[model samples]
Target chain A: MRILVLNPNSNPEFSAQMDKAVEPLRFGGAVRIDCISLTGTPLGIETQRDIDAVLDPVCDAIAAKEAEYDAFVVACFADTGVASAREVTSKPVLGICEGGLSAALNAGERFGVISTSNEARNAELRLIRSHALMERCAGMEPVNIPVVEMMHSNELAERMVSAGRRLAAQGAEVVVLGCAGMTRHQALLQDELGIPVLDPVVSTAAMALGAIAGRG
Target chain B: MRILVLNPNSNPEFSAQMDKAVEPLRFGGAVRIDCISLTGTPLGIETQRDIDAVLDPVCDAIAAKEAEYDAFVVACFADTGVASAREVTSKPVLGICEGGLSAALNAGERFGVISTSNEARNAELRLIRSHALMERCAGMEPVNIPVVEMMHSNELAERMVSAGRRLAAQGAEVVVLGCAGMTRHQALLQDELGIPVLDPVVSTAAMALGAIAGRG
Candidate 1:
């Protein structure tokens, strides 16, 4: 199956990070994952305006590539343009936030989220509430890092470790990285925290492969 | 990662069927799945006595093979001996029921379970309640097929299709096969029902791979 993992930001670096994030999934070659950035959009999907600006472009990208892929993943923690993309394609459309949270449910009873910033944390909470999963959420903590600065900051992993510890202290059995930019830190944080840490990109890609395989 | 998929029952036929059920996962060859059965346990775990009977043996098997596998999967819908097995090793121990339910959450809002028998359906409901997932469950419909007869029956797929249709009619967006014995029918039922169908053996195996990969 071919899966298009669309990073709805204009930053090519973030798209490359997502591609590296799913490197482990490439070992089997049973599914192909192509991570690409949306052109003519914001560098990072941080603000509400950024999210609103990318909706049409995200849908248009999916519509344009609809015949080329079996499934699509909206690789943003905010889940930008997932519902609209689904309306335009018959194939499965997955949102990373939803994928990460759902995979956590299998790993543990209550899960925590490590958001990139306080604003992102609030958005994550709202998304959980929309899914009626508020009760299953242990808590959400932010590293106070902005999406644009995630790749360049060496302190990113340290901040994430601290946030993960707080969530672990709050009785979270699993920790979910709330932004696609945090994908590279999943293994390190998981090792330090001694619990399952979910990268939404990998989780959603796995789900997409399962969805494609289920199509039979 | 090497994953031991232990079928607690003594039925070799069931073990072979499970091996066939996970064939799609073999393509990548990144993770090795070995499906095996206990030698002296009951042919099928159907009653409370059967569940109780497998706990020690399952724990014993895990203890014996603790050094050999990176993860373990208890391939039974009833989740027989999972908690006990976890105590025997630090490696991930997964129950197929948990894996299937968690995957369903990623696939849709609410899910229906297709059970092998009425007794199994009751156990499934109790299991969902224990997980605090009763609210997310659309309902469970049984095909009234016994675990031992699941492989021999010609009507298995037809009955599953009927149950899946009932679930779809009741607003179930995804259907989970409540018994590991129903693994081979996942694709056909999903095609017939026009929704995602989760086979617990495959789902749990996927989770096991994720867990093993996360350890890096």
Candidate 2:
């Protein structure tokens, strides 16, 4: 089976990070997973306009290659265009926010989201409300780091741990790493927080595998 | 893609009902879904011993045909042997209870489960606790009807709605049909109760599709 993970922004570094993060889920030779960056979008999708800026092209890309792959995962924490993508194809399409949030709920009682920015936190909260899972959420804690800085920063782990501690203090039993770019920090943050930490890319990829498995 | 939903019991009539319940989920020619009753088990599994009695045979069937199908869905509300099956095969294996509960958490907060028997309620609650989601659950309400009776009884819809109301009074915001055999009544109960009602079989099958989609 072949699955495509689409990074909505046009940043190769972010795409590379997402690709590497999902490596643990490849499940040997039975499934092949690939991640690609969308061209002509913003470097980082921090606002609604940034998400709106690329919905059309991403939808077009999925439509263009709908038959080539068995499934698709949109690598965005806000779940941008996920409903639209599902409408365009019968194939299963999932967004990172849905996947991560669902996995967090399954992992514990109340989950808190750790995001790259306050802007992303609003987007994440809005997405959670749309899914009706906000009642089970503790709240969102921003790491105050930009998406690009997270890619190469030495303090990324500290920021995530600090935010995770605050969310835990706020009654978050489980933590969801709200940025797909923070996929590499999942294990480290979980260890630091002493609670379950979910990575959107890994969780979505796992869900995609399950969705693909259901097809069988 | 070929998917097998195993009823894990020896009742052909119950298997037939389960088969019919999933018809709406079959998306044209993209996937083929078949429901079959397993021999050597009870007509209905109402106890932990019954689940134990069928685990080996069910695992054997999965392992025997492991190469033939893409994934498996255990059609019991008890989610019999799902973990063991995953340990035995690399393919995706889902318990209806897990799928339905996860989907419920995604759909709303404070979900309730409606089951066919008091015994089934115990099993359902145990499974919820095992998933660390007991806090999110309002409680379990039994219809007081046996699984086989639900298949032929005209009162099934009314029973589900009554149970749903009781659950609602208990603070359940969403309802999950706790039996895979109750799949046909999901839409009716949802409309009558004015809350989202989840059919375990349908949710598991849709989840299976997502799991399968992830495989690529």
Candidate 3:
């Protein structure tokens, strides 16, 4: 089976990180995962306008690749264009935010999220509400980093640890990294926080594999 | 890593089925799964009294095997004593109901559950409410079959398909088998319903594997 991990933003760095995040799941060779970035879009999906601009392009990408891939994953915390993409294909289409939250639910009763910025946190809150998981969400804290700068930010890990600690203090048993750009820090943050820190890319890939496995 | 899937009920047949349900996941050899049944409990966990009676034994079993297992899975659909078991070990402990619901959330916006009886349905509803997922739950429909008889019933698949159809009509995008004894019917039901049908045992096993992988 083949799965497409599409980063809605134009940043190739974020797409590369997402590919690395899901590398471990590819060892069994049952599924092939391809992570790609949507060209000609915003470098970072930080604003509502950025999210809106990518919706049609994301849907077009899914429709164009529907015949080649068994499943599709929208590698954005805001889950940009996931609903519309679903209307274009009968195959499974997953969003990183939904995938991360689902993984958190399995790890704990209450989960917290570490987002890239205040705007991203608000978007994630709306997504959580849509999933009817507002109660199980302990809280969302932002590191105040921009998505484009996440791969280069020296204090990103420290800020993430700080946000994670605060969430844990609020009784969060699990923490979800709300941005795909933060994919590379999952193991480190999980080690420092002593709680499960989910990488949305990895969680969604696992879920997609489960979806494919169920078909047989 | 080693994982113990403890079926709180005393039925050996059910325990064997649970073992079979998770067999496909053993291919990678990264984790070992062992399914065991408590020796002196009731044949099947039905009423509230049965749920209550297995609490201590489940906790004791976890405590006794804590050093040997990397994680613990409470395989009963009621999740007989998961919270209490957590107090006995620092290892990750999962309940099939929570795992199944978490998987369902990944599969769709709204999910329906197929239960064994009215009592089991009520128990599952309580579990869903505890997880703050009542809003995402479309409904629970019971087939009225006792847990012990689920495997022997020739009409089990037909009843499950009927229940799934009703749930789909109610706008449920996914279906979850609320009983571990119903594990064998997952793929068949999914084919018949044309939607994802989750086996709680399989779902919980996948989560346990994820938890183990995250530790690295």
**Candidate 1 interface CA RMSD, Å:** 2.2
In angstroms, how far off is A15's CA in candidate 2?
1.9
Better of 1 and 3 by lDDT: 3
Of 1 and 2, which scores higher on DockQ?
Answer: 1
In Å, residue A77's CA in model 1 sits off its true spot by 1.3
lDDT of 2 by residue, B1-216 (tens): 677888898888877877776664554445677888888788888788987898887898889878888779888888888878876787768778877777665444588999888887887778877765686789888888877676777888888888999999999977888876676777778778777677667667655654554334
Task: Report the number of clashing residue pairs per model.
Answer: 1, 26, 0
Query: TM-score for the first chain of model 1?
Result: 0.97
Question: What DockQ does candidate 3 have relative to the true complex?
Answer: 0.47
DockQ of each: 0.42, 0.11, 0.47
Give one digit per residue, the lDDT tens place, for model 3 in B22-114.
766665564588999999999989999999999999999999999998889899888889988878887889888887888788778899999
Q: What is the TM-score of each predicted model, taking all chains together?
A: 0.93, 0.63, 0.93
Model 1, range B113-195, lDDT digits (tens) per residue?
99988888888888888776777789899999888898788999999999999988988998999877787787789888878
lDDT on C-alpha atoms for all candidate structures: 0.84, 0.76, 0.85
Task: Provide interface RMSD per model, one decimal.
Answer: 2.2, 7.8, 2.3
Please give the lDDT score for candidate 1: 0.84
- In model 1, where do residues sit more than 4 Å from their true spots? A28-30, B28-30
Report the alpha-carbon TM-score of model 3 versus the true structure: 0.93
> Which residues of candidate 2, in runs, are more than 4 Å off?
B1-98, B101-145, B148-216
